[model samples]
Target: MEVAFSGINIYSKKPEAVFEFYKKLGFRVLEEVAPDDKWYGSTLALQDGDNAPIIWIWRQSDEDNSVVCNHFVFSTNGKMDEVYESIVAAGIACKPPFTAVWGGRELILHDPEGNELLFL
Candidate 1:
């Protein structure tokens, strides 16, 4: 059950501003989704790194305002289900695992303070 820190998802009322700021700081756009898409956002990776994306800037959606959870995500090394089950068995509350718009299996857990942690 290997895991690696993936990235942070930032909800922004001004996604373009956030994008521009990161761009000026040497982050390259890895992918972008239009507003009409299921997930309107951009994935950004550092210019000099071969690692996976480190930042996700998501446009705030009016219809699903509750969907945006400022979360730190982690890759489960293809063991998302196993890890999810383990967490649940330990009596932690978690949302059912689901497939994310980016096509990765994901599970979200809430901390005591109600902050979310996403596992993919």
Candidate 2:
């Protein structure tokens, strides 16, 4: 047997809103999956062109089919505070920014679809 994780998919009622949310945090939309994808929304990818694995997100209803999807973590060079600023500018409600035990700044916020983004 062979196993390799491809990406993460998050169901959202407002995937585009979630898209814009992540785009501010540095993710690019690779393409939409369906033609009338407005119902199922889209699939987004974060690609830097260096063999970096891409993350995928989908827009779908969670009324029935549901599973586990944790918050995504992002690593920054040195703009943790800049992230805080962006959140504030976006007027996005985020958990209070704080330092972690490993001496990293961390922040948590939920997308319109209810997925969490843990920025560190």
Name the best candidate (by TM-score): 2
Give the lDDT of residue 31 in candidate 1.
82
How many residue pairs clash per model?
A: 0, 0
Residue-level lDDT tens digits of model 2 in 43-101: 45566664545656666664756655567777655787887887787666676789889
lDDT (tens digit, per residue) of candidate 1 on 1-120: 988868777766557766665555356788877755555698888634665657887776656556444555566789987877777665565678998899878887654324466777
TM-scores of the models, in the order given: 0.44, 0.67
Pairs of colliding residues, candidate 1: none
Candidate 1: list runs displaced more than 4 Å: 35-39, 47-50, 63-120
TM-score of 2: 0.67
Q: What's the distance in Å from true for residue 66, model 1?
A: 8.1
